[model samples]
Target chain A: MKSKTIKASATATLINELDKALSDGFKPTLAIIFSSIKQDWKAVCNMLDERNIKVFGATTAGEFIDGDIEEGSIVVMLLDMNTAYFKLEFLETSEKTTFEDAKKLGSIGKKTFSNPAFILATGGIFIDGEHVIDGITEGFGSEVTVFGGMAGDDLIAEKPIVFTNNKSKDNAIVALIIDKDKIDVRGIASCGWEAIGTTKTVTKSEGNIVYTIDDKPALDTLMKYLGVEVKLDETQEIVAFLNSWYYPLQLERENGDTVIRATRFANQKERSLICTGSVAQGSKIKFSLPPDFDAIETVVSECKSIKDNPEQQADALIMFSCVSRHLSFGALMQEEIEQVQNIWNAPMVGFFTYGEYGRSKIGNNEFHNNACCVVALKEKA
Target chain B: MNQNLQTILDFIQQSKHLSEDEKATLTKAAKDADKALTISEFKLVRTEKVKRTTAILLEETIEELEHKRKAIEDSNNALQKSLKELKATQSQLIQSEKMASLGELTAGIAHEIQNPLNFVNNFSEVSKELLEEMQEELEEGNLEDVKEIANDVIQNLEKILHHGQRADGIVKGMLMHSRSNSGEKESVDINNLVDEYLRLAYHGLRSKDKSFNAKLETNYDDSIKTVNVVPQDIGRVVLNLITNAFYAVNEKNLLQETQGDKYEPTVSVATNTMKNNIEISVKDNGNGIPQKALDKIFQPFFTTKPTGQGTGLGLSLSYDIVKAHNGELKVETKEGQGTKFIIKIPII
Candidate 1:
């Protein structure tokens, strides 16, 4: 099996680039990471002329390369790992497959492979990617770990793309299969945000739109909380913060503040937060989470500690940081990257995801938002 | 020493010769340049490929999205159509409800008119017999007997005419109730209208339940001149008030009967000319409206009556008509006692 790593330097042909890279080395397997302002799939196809190698990739909110971050550029990495002992599974579906389907799909994996990993396309926007991932988890059932990102657009409420082994379509879900004994794979996921403020009551809501709060319109309630009138453009800014800092409620009994997590927002006349999950009809809520650096540092520390386990080792770290946290700590983004790099010495790749999800470290089958969840993949002993 | 090779390479150099280490460094330095060139060439060849793929994918995506968009649009149209239909149906129902109540009232008036016609027929036949007997007595030259008989005939005829006139007044009131009054102000004999409305209103109550009865009093300002007012409209107002009072009294009576309490329900109609206006009141000695329902009494479509019995528009329409006439309609009531609706229409 032949493997190679090919990357872009300027605006040129990816075919020639790949051909040149493949010419010198032994035949190699490929793993490409491309970040471009424009659609570069044609260039990608030039690289994939031969169906000899399986491909898996995602669009990044921002791409990192050469020890620095680059926007609107494509970075392709083709490894020379062997193609033997590895299998690639492609999932294409129009009908929304259920947990039963995910389990059925997951059951295809070995009871225990020397090294087994699963990558699924978490829906980019509006779709519940976590639920999809959870379905896959049900298939694996603590047998194998899972990792992937809900595909993304340019944060455009416009058309978003989800790539599979075949094509990109609007109503499509995809999953990639990476077999055991091919590569020692590692995955890390985190949003790097903490719960702060007081919990709020989602008094009256319909689907994703919250009509009233404490029996008043949600917009008025939020304005009263902040003690300022919200302008139109600022609505998105408010919603983004609300999604990151509010709605998936939790009670802080000592302070009497109920935390809320905003799952989605209904784009109606009155913009409202679609809570991550349903709230009880009369539940009281508040915006409460400590905006402390120590809270963030703790996540970094926790992610690093996963790497120290003798049974597990880190080869690659994938971080899906919440876009709100990305915006909140604009200049501090590098610090977050650095902190992670210091902890887990591995090749890191991921995006500033629109929303982040993973099972809570606190426990339960529940997925979380606002906070970074780390998934570390190590070769099986 | 290698100038010949360098010069020759400069002239004819395909420049492919270099050590592995040197080549590695050169490729590393030129990776970005190499990547761009490869991207451009790859893009040209792959452009066609991407176009086909994108077009096909776009068609599929747009088709799916269009299907969804169409579904949403269709549903919206359907919902709007349904809403409009609902509104139309509601208005039709309200109009039908009003017509139904009017039908019931007309039937009651027809029944009331039949009673007076019977009286006129009975009295006319009795006078015919008395007249024949008087003629025979006159032929026999008994003048005293004839005089007494003649007197009796005249008295009986007067009773017939009096009862006939009262029946005529009630029939006229009922007829006016059916007609939408011009509501135009005219020189109205306030005293007479009060007197006429009193009888019709009393009859309206009696028609509802034969047992229902009320006392009426009038202290008309005989000295005061007639006022400009809509007599027919005012009469209907009085009629409605009386009917409502009768209902209240009837309800009280029923409740008392059930409780074995023997208390006769009484409604009183009174009229007094004040300084600048005439005040007419219909008071019922029955359970008054609750405090909560008081304010809402004049609101359209509000009723304490069971369905099919009241249209609930009487007071509301009366309120509106009175307001238009620049008159005041006021109600004073107490629980377990009585209620009085006072109407003060000004005379200008």
Candidate 2:
């Protein structure tokens, strides 16, 4: 298998780069695009469709290209493989149908591929992403490799767009299924943030809206920890939501793996927290501090361990890095991405997403926020 | 750019192509440069040592602060525990004090009322006997009109005797309420105790509120054998729960009247002998406790009544009494519906 990555700021530039990579008797079987929301997604989809290329992608907060990360640009990874088969599926989801839609996608992939590596992307603003994984895992079981991310809107906090060659959808999940006899897929999800303060139980919650923590209003408890005066009557909803990016709730799963969920929105009138994903009532959660320089090292190290496996040669790499990491690391995020780039020195493409989806070391597949998920696909020789 | 340094640099630059004697001079200058580098390295090491020491001290101080914080937290927890115990003791003392005062007043009233009650009983009996003797004389056909009037007097005396006995029963109940139990266990009839308290509580509330009335009901299992308990303490618990039940129904009744709704206020006391325990339940159809306040109903100083109406210690003290008897007190309630307090004491 062979792959190539290209970065472009405009449609023409993107097409030009694609042309260059598709030259020399190379015909891409699939193209994975991660474009900024500012780019013209319709035009880009039309251009790829004209070339008879199968396309799957979503808009991103920021795109990762070559060895650098850039905003307002598009990154595409085109794969030219010998024996692997690729299938794309899209399912529209809403608050009521997210789980069933995920299950439907899973059942479709199960019937289509014998050995499948599933890649998924969905809108980040609504829908409990955790239950989506639950539904898929229910159908595909724990043995199937599942990895993906929730689509982002460049920190605009609006709806994000996901697309296949046929149509673009706002609240939908787009999946890429890879069935191969000789390709090996592995992934790692890691969050380097440390928990601060004491653990608190979710006292009152319904779905993704948490009304109380430790029997206090969830918003008030969070504000108390942040040392910010809780202004219930004031218009501080936006500030509260923005401030929550630094202190996501870290929930430990029954299997001993931890997943972080950040507050996507705040209800001022109700004084509740709307998380990126659902948290169970009575679940113990801890507020996590922002990642320091050591976190950069930890992520880089995790990437290297996967990339430097002597037994397998990595051919393609895809990353779902949480946008909160960008806010936490600032310019140092570049070095962290570069360090991972140095590991495989291969074709890589990714985007900073609102939430990431991957399996941890000791747990089943999970959806996470404020963490980095790295997927490395290698072709067995 | 010093003269000596410049000469050394120039010799090193020219040393590659120089003779052995010039190379020897270059070697000497190189050794001097090595010495200067060593000196700088030593200075850096010393600076790093100071920084390392300072960092170590800071870490130790942070550790000390953490320890102190934990100590303070533990101390605060201990103090909070002590405060809780103190409050409980205060509540117990207040309840005991209230009972003591009520006992003193009831004892004095009983003493004063018993004297007149005895006289009423004695005089009524004497008057009935004299009326009977007159009826005999009338039967002998002498003073028939006088005999008829004596019959009316005897009937009135009988009425006075019946009412006096009823008042005496009430006085006895009040005296029992004021009596302190010695915590001695005895095989007491649970049915009789519950029945007595039900009437006492109902009449007690009726006396306080002229309009308050409730339909009191009881269902006692005939097969229920007597259980060992401190009769006085158990009686107090029964009375407290029954009184609350009446109060709840009365409140609901008042509300129903204002809402133009007809509701029959009812309070029921039931006893059933289970396989291993005796279950006594006091149920009332009244405005139930709200959900937020339900969990704290048995807590001292928690009450829904208006000020000066309730001490809020009735349920709390009753709870302690039941718990001390190795029994469990449980309540099930629904807002705007009713509440049921169930007490289960082990047969053993």
Candidate 3:
């Protein structure tokens, strides 16, 4: 397998870059595009569709090509493989039929491809990414590899759009199915945030909205613990969202791996918290502390482990990094990407997401917030 | 060649090809060069010794600095621990001061109310005696019209006596609660103590908030006789719980008025006699404790009340007092619903 990444500021430039890649005898079978919300996604979709190029991608808060991070730029990763086959599917979902749509997408991939590794990107707003993962897992079972992220809209609170070669939709999911028998796939999800405070039990919650924690209004309790002044206004809600970026809640799973969930919205009328991922009632959670420099070491070390392997050489790396990390680490985020790049020296492309989805050390494909998920693909010889 | 100066002289004499001045010059130059070489070697040895001495001094200084840093760190840790202990003691002292002031106030109120109570009791007794004489005269057929009036007078005196005795009991309880605990255990009736504090706490809050009212109910286990306890301390615990109950209900009542909700504030005190221990529960239908604050309610300087409204020491002190008596104090609460504080003391 061979991969090439291109960064473009316009539809014409993106197509030109694609042509340049093709001229070099790199005939890509599948293209993964990560574009900023400022770009016209419809134009990009039409251009790629006219070329009869299969595509799957979403809008990003920021895009990464190789070791460089860019905002308001489009990045495309073109993959060409001799033995592997690729399929793309897109589905639209409403509040009532999100789970059903996810199940349908999962079953379609299951029937169409044998030994498939699924990559998913879903709409970020007003949907529980956890439930989508659950639906897919139910159809594909636990043995299959599932990984992806929720789309982000550049942190402007805009609607995140997902697309296929056929159409661009707002509340939609685009999935890529790769036959794993033709390629060796390895993934790792890591969040270096530490649990700082005492454990609290989730007393009342429904779907993604948490009404009460420890029998107190979830919002009030969170604000009190954070020492934030109590204000029941829109400004207060904004403050809560900003604070949650640094201090998200960490839930410990039965396998000892923790899943971080960040508050996406705060409901003042209901005095509730709506997170990017779903949390069940009676789950114990703790406020996470900001990561230290060692967290960067963790990401670098994990990448090094894969790159240092003597048996296989990785062809490409796809990263789904949480936007909160960008906010927290600032320029240090570049150093993290560069560290990984220094090791693999491969074609790497990814985008910052609202929430990440990947299989953890616990061996479960779970939804996460304020984390980094990396997928390394190689062809078995 | 110095073996000989003699050999050198002979050699110089044998050098027929050289002049005497040339030989003398060569000999002097060789001697001077040897002397300069010796001095240079000596300087090199001294310079090497200086460098070695400086290195040794640097190594010592580094070791000394490391030792000093460790000492400073140890001292800083000690200071931090001492500061923490001091803060804890300071909080305890503040609580004690509040309790002392409360004791003084209760004593003053009890003393002032006791005099008025005595007159009411004494006057009722005299009135009852006069009514009896009149009843005897009517029975003797000397005062038929006054007989019905005498019975009415007797009934009125009995009612006054009953209420007056209740007031007297409250005053006595206040006096007991105000007195400093002598650190001596006494076999005190647990039911009476709980009932006394319930009334005292109710009246205490009523004196502050005139519109505040709560239905006080008591269910005492008649089977529970006297149990050994520090009466004053136990009484304080009961008073703290009941006072908190009344405050909760009053706060809830205020909210109810604004929301147009129908809520009857109620505070109930109940005692149960168990095989090994006795349990006293003070419950109220008030805005309950928030669950996040429940675990910390007994921590010093932790309070939900606004500044100047609470010392944040009541529950902490109460917990300590209960523990000192080898008893357990536990609470159950639901947000916006109610709270129940249960005090369980061993029968021993």
Candidate number achieving the greatest DockQ relative to the actual structure: 2
Q: State the lDDT at A82 in candidate 2.
A: 48
Writing each residue's lDDT as its tens digit, candidate 3 over A1-381 gives 889999888878987988898897777767789999999767877777776667888999999998799999999988876533767888988655777888887788789777888888998487788878888877777777877888988886558888888777778889888778877777877778878655778999988889999898998877666543333565554323655676688987777778898987778878888888788999899876567656899877765665446454679888999998887676568778777766667789999998888876555788888888888888767
Provide fnat values for all models in the order shown: 0.00, 0.00, 0.00
lDDT of 2 at A44: 79
Candidate 1 lDDT over B180-221, as tens digits, reads 456577787766776655555566556666776555555566
Report how far residue A186 has shifted in candidate 1, in Å: 5.0
Question: Candidate 3: which docking quality band?
Answer: incorrect
* Root-mean-square deviation of Cα positions for candidate 1 versus the true structure, in angstroms: 18.0
Order of models, best lDDT first: 2, 3, 1
**Candidate 3 chain A lowest-lDDT run of ten:** A230-239
Model 2 residue B54 distance off true place after TM-score fit, in angstroms: 22
* TM-score pick, better of 1 and 3: 3
True interface contacts retained by model 2: 0.00
Could you say which candidate leads in TM-score? Answer: 2
- Compare candidates 1 and 2 on TM-score and give the better one: 2
Q: Write the per-residue lDDT of candidate 2 for residues B73-142, one digit (tens) a residue.
A: 9999999999999989885775574584354334334554566677677777777777777777778777
Superposition TM-score, candidate 3 onto the true structure: 0.52
